[model samples]
Target: MKAIIVDDERLARKELASLLASHPEIEIVDEAANPDEAVEKIEKHDPDVVFLDIQMPGKTGFEMLEEMERVPQVIFTTAYDEFALKAFDYNALDYLLKPIQPERLTESLNKVTIKSAKSEGKDQKLSSKDQVFVKDGDKCWFVKLEEVRLFESDGNYIKVYFDKFKPMIHKSLNALDERLDDRHFFRASRKHIINLGWVESIDTWFNGGLLVQLKGGEKIEVSRRQSARFREMMSL
Candidate 1:
């Protein structure tokens, strides 16, 4: 698996890289001293995993993640105490203290390996007739796919809109797009996926795109690249 080491401290980066040498399965493609470099390298290499430091000079690890559209498997390296770390949701990914233990690193890598293996076979997308389980905080709902009017990307989460409630779930918009049945839902833009059945009208938009108004009172702009295809699909 390709990996990138991101830390403001040079020593920390070097130490992590040295330790990672033993694991031949993980190749250190590049190293970054700050979030900008990290983001650039991440986009360029598209590594399988990233060893990211939680604290940095300008942008923190959380902020870096927020800037990214598609995030890879992240194993955080932090100096924060367990009590303080509880305030933020790191999506149940493994985290290591500043002075990371070798055995713990091995354990985290094992978990990542198992997780990656499990995700490789789930290729079938969810159809319009399928029901999806959504949970946000303490509330839960099992909503049928047809009932959902929209799926909006909000930072690191996706907001699922159905009836009178909109619940947020931690997921990537692109990943959700891949899992959804395209015949029922349409990728209107990078930030939105509108239910085709809920679309009320369509009008000409800027740059040869389309402005779509859904029954739920949402106005979504389909990108220029996706507009022609949208026209073709919606046409007789």
Candidate 2:
């Protein structure tokens, strides 16, 4: 599995890399001494796993992860046991306290191996019907396919509505549209995409547009351009 180590301390990075050398299955692709550099490396390489330090100079590991659209398997390595609880709260694979024991490191590496294999299969089968990892504030969920009601565009991000929460993901609505199944989802307007299954009612709106009401009580307006397709689908 391709991996990268992110730690502010240069010695920590070197130490982890040296220890990981014994595991031939893990290829050490790169290392970063700060969150900014790590972010750049992660974006450029897109490694399978990342050994991240919880507390860094500018950005914490959690802060860095928040910026990513799709996150890989993460194993947090930190000296403070105080953050261990918070570490796992984010669904991290493992948390190794420093100075990291060889046995502990080995166990974490094993977890990485298993998680990476699963992620590989998931990445290959990318579909809108597939589950996605989402986090908003202190809440997080692995949301399933059929539960999502709508996707609203918020500039560069998309707000995913599932269950009771609307989590913002760093992915464009247009990009998400390309991955979704057209039979199940429809681009109703420039700012909205509606799940056809969740649409509760439709009514004519002003200026040749149609207003769609969802089961969750959210309304989306279908533009004039898409009203013809919407009419054809709903025609008796």
Instruction: Give the best candidate by lDDT.
Output: 1
Q: State the lDDT of candidate 1 residue by residue for 130-155, as single tens digits.
A: 54556465344445678899999999
Cα-based lDDT at residue 135, candidate 1: 48
TM-score of each: 0.55, 0.61
Model 2 / residue 188 / CA error / Å: 3.2
lDDT of 2 by residue, 107-213 (tens): 98887543323423323433444445575665455455578999999998889888777878778888778767777788898889888889899898999999999
lDDT of 2 at 42: 78
What is the C-alpha local distance difference test score of candidate 1? Answer: 0.79
- In terms of TM-score, how similar is model 1 to the real structure? 0.55
Q: Can you tell me which runs of candidate 2 are displaced by over 4 Å?
A: 111-135, 138-149, 153-158, 162-165, 168-186, 194-224, 227-236
- How many times do residue backbones clash in model 1? 0
**Global lDDT of each candidate:** 0.79, 0.78
